[model samples]
Target: MTPNALLLAHDKPAALRPDQLRQFQELGYLVLPGFLDRDLVARMRHEVDRWVDDGLRARSIDSVKDPEKFGVPPVMELELPAHGELITWSPLLEILDQLVGAPYAFHHLHSDRQAPDIPGKPWHHDYEHSTQTDRSATMIHALHYLDGLSTDTSSLVVLPGSHRERVDKTARAHLGTEPLPGEVVLEELPPGSTVVLHSALFHARRPRPGVLGKPRYFVDASYCEVGPLWPPVKPYWRYMLRRARELNLAPDRSELFTELTFAEYSRPA
Candidate 1:
């Protein structure tokens, strides 16, 4: 409806709320521009460049013009000790949990890039890997753009909450398949703002690719709960560690669960 109503998507559980979270279910995507600090953007861009150069030198590659096509594809793992200081400890994920009202874990980053003047990629849900149907099943994508991303240079096309529908084989084709039957919304965010979406929402990318070798850059990570953190739906267990170190829940979040991790949760699975 209004940008003011849209900003509330982040401040939920009390102060602010995401009217769009519900809207995304029906529309497929949302956008918030100029929502991040310039310094954070600069630091992220620098880290990305350093990671790319390191990969090139290590692999002795002449050029890495099309990493977004697929595979491990040379993306920087922002969690590495080297890049951790750049911007890891943001409380965004915790707030994200409150928004989704579910437990989720950090998924991988795409280390994405697209060449000059390329069309949008195939339309698909970001949760391409997971097969679970827990309504708690959702993904939060925090995309930080670098190098002046715009509607002309590039923008994300979403089918607004298309996650509810089953995957269409036609749209899964390699020829940059089209969006399903729904309105196409474009996200023209500034350099540092984040794009958060559910795991099921259908979204596509249109890359303008300014120069020949240059491409757009964005980072994505997903979150899941600790209860369903492991497989076979095993009881989530942990040791006497008072703190949760990414792999397990924090003591504050799961005190009894943490204590019962080894004793109770760790059954057969």
Candidate 2:
């Protein structure tokens, strides 16, 4: 697909066009510029500020790194009202239903306000298959850029069609965030844009060094196509799902928070 074709306006259509679905299936990612409502985006941005300023984000990280001591986080990103709504945003789910093409379970949600000087991330994918086996089933990450991308912000660089390769998540880490052939650099987007990615697609965050611009508000959520017992990334993943269920985050979608979708939680070696 052409670079311009990669981006679709956020019309919240009843169903995605056949070509849009085909774009995601073929190129392994779809850019939905201004996918979220401005009001919702504002609310989410407020919550993100509270999440960071209140030390909740650090606590959540601590819980993950030392679950034995920290246990479940005092609050999860989904617990925030705006974030909860975002998790079950009907239009987003409808698109996921089309892309995933089957019942899927909520994998995880993360919120952050990245500093202007945040370092670039090496190329990697977040696909979670327990044994690094086949990619028969689909998994996706909805990357929500609340404040959106700009020359001042770190740009997202994705290697098109990389999900088809059955490789490790960091197979291209040696390349750092350097430009590569066939890479798509997403640098400009309006506020509230979202990029849905095939979980195995190789992507990286390319930060512009020495420019102290505004903080980037980002929230990402992932879902796994039901069938295989996928591995849970967080140690308190059960608690996370339970909270989502209790909060009725997916009242209409019963399969969204069911623990049956996961095998067991295991820390990475």
Candidate 3:
């Protein structure tokens, strides 16, 4: 089902209100359904298929740019080449402004995927792993479910209020470990739906049984305060990380994500 671009409403946009802000503060995560444009979502998914089949896309890196992120084939999230732009800017900025309560910075753009029965991303927080002290109140994590997500597919799982827990220091597991004893929730939503969260929160994406070989497509975006750019920062990275500018994954735009070392990209990449 394609969603009309005009249909994108304020409720789901990143810009939150008094109540929505409260919900995020308390629950750590909130669902804004039917907010993303379905057509754009479709294009992104198509591109993901092409990349997974091959390795290179206009904006993504196929080779291991960082040794820490080696052994990972990074052909996914073709949305940048397909969808010109604006898929991220609208709701993303609004919600971020409300969350950060200050102008934020762009950490970098990245992608993640999990096949059925395949282990998911290591459980952890984005900012904590990056080792950067972030000042932005919110971290913008806009996801385009190129392929629609469902319950069993082990889609993106997040601990709602886990953002509040303080874990200044964390451990890294050589192999996947069972989630700590407690209830777990996956933020399963349609294509084009974007999720913004505090960098301090705990979030992970898992695999789900799809129609056989199919997999999930998603984008990992991080935002924080604007200041001296992070080391290994790119030039275009500065101009594009603005609240006024729209957030689109156009292949034409540089810094949709620049290749960064592990120290450059968030940790555990």
Full-model lDDT for every candidate: 0.47, 0.91, 0.50
lDDT of 1 by residue, 204-259 (tens): 67665444434666655544444444321111112112222443333244422233
User: Across residues 1-269, which tens digit of lDDT does each residue of candidate 2 receive?
Assistant: 23643454456464778888888888999888888988999999999999999999999999999999999888999999999999999878988999999999999999999999999999999999845669999999999999989988999999989999888987899999999999999999889988999999999999998887889999999999999999998999888898999998887899999999898888878
Worst 10 residues of 1 by lDDT: 232-241
Candidate 3 lowest-lDDT run of ten = 1-10
Order of all candidates by TM-score, from best down to worst?
2, 3, 1
Residue 183 local lDDT, model 3: 27
> Which candidate should be chosen as best, given lDDT against the real structure?
2
CA shift of 17, model 3, Å? 2.7
Clashing residue pairs, backbone N/CA/C < 3 A, model 2: none
| Segments of candidate 1 deviating more than 4 angstroms | 1-5, 8-15, 56-76, 79-91, 112-114, 117-119, 128-136, 168-171, 174-181, 209-214, 229-269
Which scores better on lDDT, 1 or 3? 3
TM-score per candidate, in order? 0.63, 0.96, 0.65
For candidate 2, the per-residue lDDT at 172 reads 96
